[model samples]
Target: MAKRSLPILSDGAAKKILRDLCKQHNVSLELVTQMIEIQRENLGRGRQIGITQDFSAAIAEFLDSASIVRGE
Candidate 1:
């Protein structure tokens, strides 16, 4: 049997990839970082039962509006 290994990404590489993705998507890295922080805070608040419905709804609304703005 042949063995295969997955390629590992360093922190710099990961950050560059994320930056490239943000650029490609026409979104600012700061906006993406803020979204991540919001999600993290929600997860902390709802750790016992997972993310709250309100948080999920907010995320859905955000995505919906983003798509609308981008005409996607």
Candidate 2:
């Protein structure tokens, strides 16, 4: 699949999304927000956050494995 760009977010939307992700993952949104801020800064400077694509692919692969295991 082709890579896609995610947009910059206002504080509210970013916080909301981060909160939802953290809740789903049983993580702390504060920590996730730190990472998001860093990613945003890197993206703003036109530097690709290296390995993000690979990371995404890896997550997809992991989920695919689970789905297969579950006969999904």
Candidate 3:
């Protein structure tokens, strides 16, 4: 199977997603970078990006968790 290009996310949105994920997972930016690399590598082997369904949901979930953590 061949891989396809992923939908391009806005830089701001992507940065926010990464930040929220790091916070939610109690991980550092370095770990987030690693996780993202892992995610990309896993998907690319099968010609995909992140799980289409899971990616947005995961980001949303992370943001929700971050907001709660911040007492928002």
> Best by lDDT, which number?
1
TM-score of each: 0.48, 0.36, 0.36
Across 46-71, the per-residue lDDT of candidate 2 in tens digits comes to 65756477446555665686679879
TM-score between model 3 and native: 0.36
Q: How many Å off is the CA of 68 in candidate 2? A: 37
Q: What does the lDDT read for residue 65 in candidate 1?
A: 80
On a 0 to 100 scale, what is the lDDT of residue 1 in model 2?
50
Candidate 3 C-alpha error for residue 41, in Å = 8.2
Question: What lDDT is reached at residue 18 by model 3?
Answer: 72
* lDDT of residue 70 for candidate 1: 86
lDDT of 1 by residue, 1-72 (tens): 432321222367777888899899886665665566555555535363544564566567767888998899
lDDT (CA) per prediction: 0.62, 0.60, 0.60
Candidate ranking (lDDT, best to worst): 1, 3, 2
Separately for all candidates shown, the number of backbone clashes (residues 3 or more apart, or on different chains) is 0, 0, 1
Q: Which ranges in model 1 have alpha carbons more than 4 Å from their true place? A: 1-10, 47-72
* lDDT value, residue 18 of candidate 1: 81
User: For candidate 3, lDDT tens digit of each residue in 1-72?
Assistant: 654443322367776787788689786555455446457766536656555554566566666876899899
Scanning candidate 2 in windows of ten residues, the lowest lDDT window is: 1-10
